[model samples]
Structures are given as C-alpha cells and as structure tokens.
Target: MTTETAGGPTGPAARPAPHRVVIVGGGVTGLVAARQILRDRPETTVTVLEASERLGGQVLAIDVDGVAVDVGAEAIHLGAPAAADLARALGLDATVIAARRGQSVLLTRRGLRPLPAGVGPTGPTRVGPVLRSGILSWHAIVRAGLEPLTRRRQAADVAVGDFVQGRFGREVTDTFVDPLLGNLHSGDIHRLSLQATAKQLVPVAESGTSLLLRALRKPTPPPRRPDEPAPLPMFASWPGGLGALVDALASSLEGHATVRTAVRVEAIGRTGDTWRVDTGEGPVEADAVVVAVGPRPAAVLLGPHSPATARALEAVDTASVATVVLAYEREAAEQNPVLRDANGLLLNSSQSGVLKAMTNMSRKWPLGHPSWHIVRVSVGRAGSRVAVDLSDAQMIAAASGELATLIGLNATPVFATVVRWPDAMPQLTVGHPGRMAAARAELAGIPGLHLAGSAADGLGLTSTIASGVQVARTLVG
Candidate 1:
C-alpha cells in the first residue's frame, strides 16, 4: 500500500514498548547477565532478583587483621580476552595485580619434591622434566614414556583420571593429578567429566592424539604495546581482591537496572506471552527470564513446568570444601626455607591428611603488608566429610599445626580465620554436559525460559561468566 507525503502513512500504528528481561539469582552469572542485557538491549527494562542479601555470591572478600583477602574466589586469567575486555570496559586495567613469581611443590611418598616444569594438573607436557623430578617411580616414568604407543580408547566422553591413567599410569594420577585437579573442583578425578571440565581435551581424547604433544603446542598471547604496564600475566586480581570485580559490575549496572537483594523468587511460570517471577511480596513479570542460580534452586523453580529440566538439574551432584586463612609474622614465616620462594604446596590424599593444599598468599600476591605473611590452607574434597563437621576453632588449630609440621612454622599465627562452603562446588560427572544440553534443548521449546551459570556450564569464572554473556545475546536476538 503506497502512502502520501510529509504527513507520512494514512494510518500510523504505535510501536510496541521496549522489551523487559528478568534475571534470577544475584551471583556472578546473574550480575553479568544483568549488565549485559542493559548493554546489548539498551532500551530494554532490566530487573535483577537476588535470593540472598549478598549479590556477589562466591566472589567474596573479608578483612583479616587489617589485610584484605579473598575468602572465596581469589584470581582470574586476566590475559584471556573475555576477562581482559571486561576489565578494560570496567576501567580496571591499571589496578590488575599479577601472581608473584614462585614455585609449587608436591608432597609425594618421597617427601616434598619440586613440581617438574611443563607439568599440569593432568600430566607432564614434557617427559624429560618429570623423569628427573622423580614424582613418579622409575618404573612409572618408563610407563609414561611409552605413551606414544598406548592403545587408543576413543569415546564421546571419558573421565579425566582414566584418560591420564591410560596415557601415564595410576601412580602419576594418584601422586600428582589427583591432588591438584581434585582440590580445584572439590570432586574426585575419576568422577569428573573430561568433556565438561576441559572441552579442548575432548577432541584430543576422541582423536587418540598424544596429549603431551598437543599440550606443547599451546597458544601464544598477542604482543603487548610498549606503553602497556608490564606484560599482563596469565592471571590478575584487583588490590581489593576478586570481590572488586563483582563490585565494579554492580556499579556499572546502576541507573540502567533495578537490582533487588534478599528478595526470594519462589517460582517462575509462563502466563500468556510474558513470564511471571513470583517473589514473597508479589509477582514480577517480564518478556524473558534467565535462571542463573545453582542447580538445586534452579530445579525447584523449573520443576512445575519443565519436569525434565528439573530432573536433569536434580541429578547434578555437588561436593563441599573449605578455605582457612592464617596470618604469621614475616620474619617468623620466612625463617622456613620453603616460605622464601614457595607459591604453594600440594599434598596427596594418602599423605598426612586434613589439609590437602596451602597457598602462600603473601608471596603469591603483593596486596598485603610486608610485615605479615599470610597463607591460605585448603581442606576437603569429594567423598570426604572431614571439613563438614569440624568447628571453626578446630579447623584453624589443625591447619596451624599442619603448617608447623610441614615447614617448621613453629611460631604461633598472628591472626587466623576459617570460611566453610557447604556443597558449593557442582560435580560435572561423566555424561553430565550432554544430559544438560539435551535438557536445555528440550527447554528451548518453551518460550522466554533459559538457564545460565555454573550449574549449566560447569564451574570456573571463565565458563560461568561466558554462559551468562551468551544468554544476554540470546535475549537480544
């Protein structure tokens, strides 16, 4: 239908109002989504609903005797594009701090041994360094040397521990990988999924390629500009700690978003073309909704409408772990030879128990005062409930005693604190990602409903934040 001149069309139709997107949960995933939605869909009205009073979730910080330290997540790979881009946009480029140079030692049957170069959580990238380090026996080293001839067992998915064991042997997996990766995920190595945990390795596992060779062909970072401060390390954290990242995200969301805290979302359902997010007070409606909470809470919300999704979420299990921080006099701690150049120390499960690893926080990061040396002692893992029942005082004492025994830290700590995370880490077991994908694909049939977070994408800051960013783009389209 052709219309006339300056008056425009004969009959004008009013355009619809801007879209409304409701984000559930207030953790890193939810917060990232909220900021992203506001950025991508500038006209869209955004509201973030948080179940708890805290908005950052695991990105938390606390002051221990005048020193600010992360009680939750501590650092991130600032060199990675996603983190770098986000930090640049947030005006945090100048404030990033690198992990100070040091070495990590492994507590093996032969006692404390320096971790060989080119070694990772799974296995050594080069056999030469490991052969000399003696973390494994002569016989085990010989077995690993035969990795090029190892039989290929291709599958769609496999356990990380099994993959390492097939290429190396049980001794390598138990002595090295189990202590490193196990503590990282707070789950068992044999149960963690290779596909979900490390997607890049899935292709290598399926191709039966030599992981050692592939690991060697690592990607190189772009050359740094001369004006840039120093080459940004692989990881960096703010002087305020990791919590600063969360605070910056929240700050950016101001004026563009309506963030509500301590407001519990009881359930979510579709009514007509909009979604109804029911809170204790009333219902908040929106055109689209993102469920970025953990698995258990997510299950509770999706149970009524999408039973399959609820079941899939319910099936995903989690393990509990704790972080205990202890501070000591700089002179006292540095007296021990290990504390001078130690970034951290890892102990096998079979070794003198309770504590599995310890991070020399003062040496690792320069945020604290030089007069005091701080250390973070990590305890608990999958299938072990030792940390679950221990009282805070008991945990502090036990960790302090372990430090004294391990490094000759005979002097009493100046200050100490313990923080417990109960069932906080999600277990991405074998076949879990496929199960989640199928559920999400099925959920696609329902309009205006989506999932994004550690529960859906697995743990780690990179994966969780990436999931939220993807969800934002989906909503915009």
Candidate 2:
C-alpha cells in the first residue's frame, strides 16, 4: 500500500524529498493514472488528493434503505478496450447482460403507448412494422422515406438537429431523435455536434448513402458462448459498484493518492519548472498538474497559465442531473419486463417533469439474493431548472411523481436517494471536437501533466476508464 502522509506537502524548514507525484482527483482517471504509474515505475512515491470524503466522484454507489443506487454513470455506453482490459486485470469479473428490450411504453398525448417493432433510438429499420404502426402520420413517413434523396453536405461541423431535420424533417427530430439521442446527452439535438454525437453516421452522410440501407447492411455478430454470458449493450458497475472500482485502483497505489476531503483548490500557479496547486490545505507541488475537475473548477484551478484552455473548458458546458432509485417487491412490478428482466427504459426527452431516464438494476444484473426490484431514474438537463435550482427533496419528489404517473403507482418509495452533479455530463456542442483537438495540442507541450475524464471524450463508465488509461499511458512513458 502507498503510504499517504496526511501531514501535507513539503515544509520550508524540512528538506524536500525527491520528485513525487500527487494526483489531484480520486476519480477513475486519477486512480487509473496512479495504477499505471506504479506499474511502470514502482519506486516513485505517489499521492492522490481528493476533495470529496468518498471516492468515485460522479461514479458513486449508495445504499438507499436496502438497495444500491448508482448515482452516476448507470452503465457503459460502449465496452471498449480500456474498460474491459482494466476490469480483467483488477480481477473483476466482466459479466454481460442484455440491454433493455421488449415493448417500450411511451407516454404521449394518447397516454402510455408502446413503440412498434423495428423502431429504435436510431430509427425504424423495418418498413413493414413502421408502415403498419401509427407512431407517425403517412405524410411524416413519406418525408422520412426521402432521406435517400436528401442533399449531402461536407461542412466541417453542423448541428445534429439541423442535419437530421434537413434529411428526415422536424417530426423525426422531435419525436424520435430528440427523445432518444437527446435523453442520452441530456441535450438538444439542434445544438449538439454531429461529429461528437453521431460520429459513425458521418461517413454515410458524406457518401450520400441511405441510413436504412446502412442499418440493413451492418453485420450482426454471432451469439456468445454458453459459459460466457453475452456482454451488456453498454458496460457498467464496478462489480461491487463504482466505489469498489475506485477502491481497487486506490489500493494498488499505496501512499500515492493524498485524499483531502472538503479542501477546495483555490488556484494554481507555475514556479520555475514546478507547478504549484494551491488549496485550502496548502500548496502542493508537481512537475505539471492535470486539472481533472469539471470546466468551472478547472478554470478556477488553471489561473492564467493557460487562459485559452480554461476558457474553452469553461465554455465546454455541462448538464446537471440527479439519479433516484426506487425499490419495490417483485410482485409489485409484474407485467413490466424492464423492471423484471431487462436493463430498464430510457425515456424520450419529450417527457415532462424532471425525470429523463430510468434503469432497472436488479433485472440487469445477476443478484445473489432474491430481493425487491431496483429502478434508477435520472432527472434534469444541461440548463434545466431541475439541474441548478431544485432542492434534493424537490428533485426526488419530481422524479417520484413521474414514476407514479408512468408506472401507474404512487406509493411512497421505500428508499430514495438524490445526487446533484453540478457539471455532471459535458455537452459536446457544435465544434466541440475541433475545440478539443486544439486544447489537446496546446497542452501537449506541458510535460508530466495529462487531462482526462468524461469531458475529454465520450460519456459513461467505459469512456471514463478509457480516459484514465490514456492518461496512464502518457504519464507512465
């Protein structure tokens, strides 16, 4: 174990020690950085300083009453190399569970209605099912069919909403794309960056190809082994929750991470070759420092060393959100396969109130003991009133009300927890990708410092892990 000196950094009266690393954050990025450093240079003393009393930062797990609630990053969007490799190396079992499937009940003007077959977040894949379904008017469907005839453009950047609207019309954007993709980003499609959001679809658009044809032509992989469960549509959890993953990474670092709970960083400055991280506790020295906090905090910490980076980061924007987990007996949730078997439902952004999405935990994982059904509800958006102004009680109430209305039940939740993330999910607005590339180039000259976390790339657990791994590789070398 890394021996952490809670006594603070070097003192003026004492002889300063050799070059040691002090990771500023204890989230997945910092933990992964510390782990990677140790693997490469086992002799270097490292310390991770965290302002929070607990680890995991946004990725947290809380026992609400008797059920565990994932306060942030409910699941991995895409299980890429970084997340998968780390889980295996840490001795954590990677079990796959199928994502939510089956009839999705939609709350519309006509009340709760089920989405017909062939239609998903992307779009309707089967013409027969879509034609037979009443989700869209014939006129709207005809407009959508004109996607193949839509004009293509080679612009550097365009709004996701504009692109989709230009091709499929407003009905598709508001009804299908907005609710599905918008809910995922906690953003509006009109303002989001196509390069950042629909990265894979860019080539198809450039080729003047058909979205339906591309969907149809996409290869489908074979089934998984009988012994190996199929991977979840998105990766998630730390086996014991995100906290466990943080703990595991922290354990490998020994004394490297200096967790300073409640000590807010005041500012950061450069002195000769060293970077001084000023905090309420004191100034900690580093060869170079990575401000892993969100844009606002990063701005506070960066000071004037890199004004452009700070400004860009500050302008990067973020959405505020809260996750509420409600538990119920198995019998109480009968008929809702999502609550009984699948991963849970991702609501369309068109839904009113503070709630946006929900996940069924017990249904998605292999539970050891039979227990009550666990469901997680995410609330608020980037600039929504629910994000900043609403109190925890208000947020919970709003979420619970929506739950009651949607599920046809209004009983008081046995366990409810609210998590307020001020700058939770970063909004990759139009030109965000270009801006990120520029920021990366500017920071490239700075040594022993690396920027990481969800804001730097995509969102979710897998991205976070990947960010950490990338930072690790940079710092280790």
Candidate 3:
C-alpha cells in the first residue's frame, strides 16, 4: 500500500512499521535463531511459529513405563562448542553428563571386534588399527597402504565412496567407511559427497600422494599435567535426554520472543519491501523472515514467489528413519557381556540389513538406569526401502531379532517404543556443497529471506545450532 501525502498517494513509502522477524519453524534451530536475534537486536520483535504441537523436531523424547526415553538424537557432539556453550549459557550445564564409556565394537564376519583406532567417520587414518583389528584382509590392507601410489582424483567434487576407496580399497570402504559415514548420514557412501560430508579427508584428498603418509607425519600431543584443566568430552547429554536442551532453549526465549505452536506458515511473499507471512490462522507482516523448517516444508512455502529458491530446496534429498527403544529384563541383560560396559555395535555394510546401529543406554549412561537394560536401535538409510512398510510392531520385532542375533540376547524386551521420522535425514550428495552455496547466493539476492536448519548446511545438533547463530547474526548485524 502507498502512503498518502497532502496532495496525492505517494509511491511505496519508507517502512513505518516496527521491525519484526517471522521465524517459520519452532524447532531447536528456529528457537535458537530467535533467541540470538533477540539478544542482538533487543528492540526488534520476533515471532516463532511451529507447525507441530511439540517443539524440538528431531530432538524429542517419549515416556515408556514412566521413564523418559529419547526417541530421536540422544547425544550432543562436543567436537563443536555450540551445543555446550548454549547449554551452559542456558544454565543446563548442571544437567549435562559425560558418557561413562565409549568403547564400541564393530560387527565383522569373525564377530564383534573393537573398531580400528585410527578409523573415523571418513575412512582409515592409521594402518596399525586396521592391522590389529583384522577386519581387513591382507590383500585389502596392502591395496589401502599403496594408496599413496594412486593418482590424485581430478574431479572438483567426488563421491565419499570413490575418495575413500581411491585412498583405501573397496573393502576398506565397505568395512570402515560404510558404518561411520554412511550410517551417520543415512545415505550411501557412493552417492554422498566427499567434499560436503567428509571434511577431514579433504586435505589428504587434495594432497594427491598418500593419506597414510600424511597421517603418520602428524604431531602427537604430550600428556596433560595435573594442573591442566580437562578437555571437553567428545559427546555429552543431559539426564533428561535432548528434550532438556529443547526445554531450556524454549524457556530462554520466554518474554523475549513470541512463540506459538500449531501455527503453520503457508506462504511467504514480498509486499512493498515488507514480508507478508501467510499462516493457517492469519497473515503476519514482518520486516524479515527465517525459514527454519526442513527443505520440503521450506520448498512449499517459498515456491509461490521464489521458484528458484524453492526448487533448490526441493532438489535436496532426504531419507526416512525410525528409532526403537527396547527395555529388556535386567537379569538377561546383566548376563550378556555386550551390555556390561561400553557403547553398542556399529553394523558394517554386510550387516546393514535391518538395523543401522544400536546404543546401549544402560551403560552409556549407567547412572540413569539400574534396573532395566535399555537399547536404542536406529533403522533405515537413504535408498533403502526395508523400513518404509514396517509398523511399530514390525520395527520392534526386527530390532529385537537383530539384537538377539548380534548379542545373543534371546529374552524378549519388557517394553518397546517406536518413533518414525519421514524424510527427515538430509542427504548431502556429490556437488551438495556447491548446490548449497548456489542456493545461498541466490537467496542473498532476495532481501529479508533466509534459510537455517539441518537442511540448510548440515545435520546434527552442533551444525544446526551453528547455522541458527549464523543466520541470526546475518539478519541482525
């Protein structure tokens, strides 16, 4: 609408309305973004609209027999300090607890064995670990060791499988990289991007000579002295599961921002330099808007006005996944050595049939449960249809059957609960980094429009939180 002057209606005048931001999703990312925006621009108005009745998105928890069980992400990766910093700042540090043990075994043809010391999410880093574990045959080991002789890959972007297999052999890719990187993204390594997903290997990938040679030349740190403070744990979580984090983040925004649940944003369009956010209830006019939902939802909202932006978002791939939390009889669990200490098992490519990985929550957080031996089982992966048709009962049965075969736990679980997330796990395919960059570059042309979520740049709590902080700073600064 044009502003009316003394003589006649003037062309679209300056924005006289108070500066307000309409956040399109109420998940952790959106809420965190809202929190940061309010902190930076104290005078600006912020509105958080969530489609679901509950917040937290994938970071959720459910009650089973009166005990809160995390059906989604349970651990907070401490490699980055975004989550830890946010938790501490929100007074959630006291509730945080470190893993009692982190020793995880790999499912091999020989049986479950300790993972190679130097093996990571990308691929093998040291030969000694693979040699000791005997997970690789001598032929594959020699092939992997000779990777220094292979020519550097010429592609600007390559598949993670190709990069790892080129540096290591195919066997190593299947045995080592599959479970860590593949299962992590719920995607196939052959399709997942090396540059986008595996950042640690880029230096070695670009080196053109040898991953092992470079790994061997790395310096080792000296032992810590008694007076030195302890480094942060690799992973941590509150006793209340990740839901505590969601609760804390939501509470931090109380009175600082307007948070509304069950409010779905239908479309976003520009009206004379102002954003008109059409929602289920009514329209919300704001100075800026942040689309923090998954790419699918974001695509639906952005398609009407910004087709290019919407298509860029819609092109992103996602996989459906389900989590099954099973409680077993204490006596049966105590007898099983696998449940005694350490984390659960990571299924290699051969064993990636019905289960992805299982977490032994009883010992991972031993203090939380003394009576029940609880296990959290992850199912589904990109391009896999095994879990698509399974119901809650079927999922539980499959999870139990696998646990029995893997750990010799024949006893039935005392309780079980299933949580399914459809098209939730985002896949970073080859050229994904470039696609994201192009999408962002295109988004920059459109003022007051921003994208921030796991779907935006990365997955997991740390990356999502970092994206939120970045989008907020960019919007408010």
Candidate 4:
C-alpha cells in the first residue's frame, strides 16, 4: 500500500493516491460520516461495514395497510439545525412536514389530563401552566412556587431526578419529569446524567434561580414579519417516513462509497501508520477508520489496541425498546372522535399500563388514507421486562388492550406489527460526560482513529448526525 501526504504530490511524476477510509457499522451515523468525507474530499475512497443485513439502524419504516409507517425513529427535532440542514442537502426539503399541533394528554390516576403547557422533557418551564394544570396538589404547587427562593448547589454533574426534585418538589418530578425525560432514555431519571440528558437545564439549575421563574422571564420570539415565510414545525419528518432519509443517504453514497451489509468487524489493529480491520470475512487496511458502532461492540473492537478507551466505552450503557403499530379502519376510529383531536398520549409512571406512550399517526401526519387510522403504542423501558420477556403475540395483545381501555375502542385493528429494538438507545447516566471525555482523549492519541455515534453524543437525530459530521470533518482536515 502507498501513503499520500495531505498536500498531495510535489511533482507531476507522482500523482497523490486517494485516501482510503473504512467505517464500521453502517448505521445512520456511519453513513453520514461517509457522505461528509466523500463530499469534503472527492479523492477519498470510503467503505461502510454493517453487521446487519440492512442499513438505517433505528430509523426503520414498515408497510402497514398499504401505507409506509415508521416503526423506529419517527421525528427529528426542528429546534436543531443539523437534521434539517442534512434533509435539505439531500433534496428532501419538500418532503419534510411538521408534526400537527394538537393536544397530547397524560394518563394520570384521576384520568386523562392535558400535559401542562410549557412543561417540557426537563421540567416545567412556566409556573402559570403548572399552577393551572392541577396535575399537582395545592401543597405541592406551593412548594414548586417557592423554588426561586430555594438555594441550589453548584455541581459539575448530578442526576436528573435529583436535580428536578430538589428544585420543583417530588410531585413535579414524578408527574412531569419522570415520564418525559425518563421515557426518552427508557431509563430511570435518578440515574440519568443531568448534563448529558438535559443540558439546557444545567444553567438554570446552577444559577440558583427558580427554574419556573427563569422560564417565565424568558422572552418570546418576535412575530414573523408579513414578508417572512411560515416557520417550520417543532418536529419534522418525511411524508413516506424516516426511512426515506436512510434510503436517500445510502443512494447518495453509491459511487462515492461502498456499503457492505452483513459484514461484522471482529477486531481493529494498527500496523505502523495504517489501521487494519479484521472482519468475519477477512482483514482490510485503511488510511483512516471511523468506529460508529454501539459502545459495547466498539469496546470489543478497540480493546486490543487501547484498553483505556475500551474501558471508557464500556461505562456507557444502553436500553432496549419495542414499538407496536396498530391500524384501525375509519369506522373504528369514528367511535372515538377524541383520537382525531389529540396527537398522542403519554402515560404517567404512576398509571397502571403496559404502554409508556402512544401516538396517533393518522392525525400527526398525512398518511393519505382517509379511511384508515394508524396508532403506535410504545412498550418497555430500561430495567423493565414488559417487552423483553413477552412474545410478539403477547406484545400485540397488551398494546391492543391498553388502547381499548384508554380510547374506549371495541373494534380490532386491521393490521398490527411489533418492532423490537434491542440495545437501541444509549443511556447517558451520571459521569457519562467525564467517561466519554477520557475515552476521546485516549483515542486521540491513536492517529487516524475516530469514534462517533449516540454513545459519544446524546441520542436524537440532531446529535447523532452532528457527531458523524464532526468526526468526518476532523478526518478530512
């Protein structure tokens, strides 16, 4: 093999050879990284190795009643620019649509109550909404109101549950924070890292000001000018489904990179300046390598080369989840007109149910089927065996029963499918930032080696795609 310098050849007699890069794990992160590398350096040759037979790791779409529905990741945060920018770059701007602005209820013991306006994944952003929502008792409300007067400790890291409970009281933490933030990781809020999961709340928490007060003090953005275009929705996705994104990314990389599925990378070794990757089939060499696989698998591959990096990677944990899709005819949905008004519902941890959340797909997006209604029920969470131990039939039955009870639906769905994602979401528990920092620092010493994925950053379309792009730019430089 020949090596080329960054500046290319000094004379015409010697033309610089193309840089060869091999990416492990053909998930969205790996694919995005490959695309960035190819775009930035057209002379670079890229290869993507995936252990599974297909691509798009968690971003998957399945056919339900002749319409494409997303079983895995369904929406992208419009608050973040990475995903939107990438979508536009891929010529998917026209296909992008925002989530319908509809009321989403919370299943409390008292019955279904609207999720207090201004309450978010972290906690209650505005006090007026929480005060009027009646989700908390009068005494709990008083305690939450006194948050601004309370003293807060300045800690580098803390648990989300601990921080929120300390500031807003247990009632708020249990009713609002737990279901919203905890469900995001499919894990307990008490174990999730405050900095890693809810970084937006860090400044508010450490400022010693009441979180609710600060939220109220926040100024609203100015109204759009008459000449300005309409704003995008808070969440956006392709009409076909999120899978369209995966398909587009893969197609864009056709001649620029080679994507090989069903190819598992066993180990990674370094020989002098070049990196050697050993797959199930054979060994391959590359000028640079990007490891975008899950943390555990990445640890296994990097153990021999860097034990410290492996140890750090091992510290990151993951959670499994399953999404059950149910399609109902228009007649079945007509029995419950409320389904048409609301976008979805989230279950409180205190509620007795197998489902953590449910989304009314037909209302949230335009499925183009007026006679059909699609609903997605999510089951299982970190440390929960509801989905792991149950069979497909059991999962479907549980979801069906829950929907019937919640929506008063007696009719059966026209189609039902269960999609299980094992170890799909990474849990960024306390100390995760420090752990990742140490790992990245150690890996930096190894030239031409980079790590990028949800494990390195936080989980979400924005963070994952940004991680891939950042690593790709670093390699290109």
lDDT of 3 by residue, 1-477 (tens): 434222121233233445699999988899889877766665668999999998898988887666677888888886576866676567666667787765777887678877777778887677676788888888987888787687584454689888878777888888878888888888888998777776656665675756778777767878989986455566888776888888877877776678899999988878889999988899999989999999899888766667666766777789999888999888888788787754878887557667889888877874356578888988998877666778889889888998888888768898888888889888878877777787788778888899999876688888889889899888875
lDDT head-to-head 3 vs 4, winner:
4
Cα lDDT of model 4 overall?
A: 0.81
Report the Cα RMSD per candidate.
6.1, 6.0, 7.0, 4.7
Q: What's the CA RMSD of model 3 in angstroms?
A: 7.0
Better of 2 and 3 by lDDT: 3
Question: lDDT of candidate 3?
Answer: 0.79
Badly placed stretches (over 4 Å) of model 1 are 1-17, 151-153, 215-231
Write down the lDDT of every candidate, Cα atoms only. 0.79, 0.66, 0.79, 0.81
Q: What's each prediction's TM-score?
A: 0.91, 0.82, 0.91, 0.91
How well does model 1 score by local distance difference test? Answer: 0.79
- Cα lDDT of model 2 by residue, 438-467, tens digit: 777767766655577766666666666777
The reply for model 2, stretches above 4 Å from the true place, is: 1-19, 40-44, 94-104, 108-134, 205-209, 220-233, 255-263, 335-343, 366-371
Error of 4 at 56 (Å): 0.8
In the range 1-477, model 1's lDDT, one tens digit per residue, is: 223222111122122358888899888898888877766656678889997888888888788767788877887876556667667667677788888866677887787777888767676777677777767888887787677689485774688888888887889898878877777787888888888876767777788887655555666768978976554567778887888788888887876788999999999978899899999979999988899988898989886777778877898887777899988898988887667788888876667477888988888888567588888898887777867999999889998899788877768888888998877888888878778887788778887788898878878787777887888877766
Question: Residue 196 lDDT in model 1?
Answer: 80
Best by lDDT: 4
Query: Which 10-residue window in model 2 sums to the lowest lDDT?
Result: 6-15
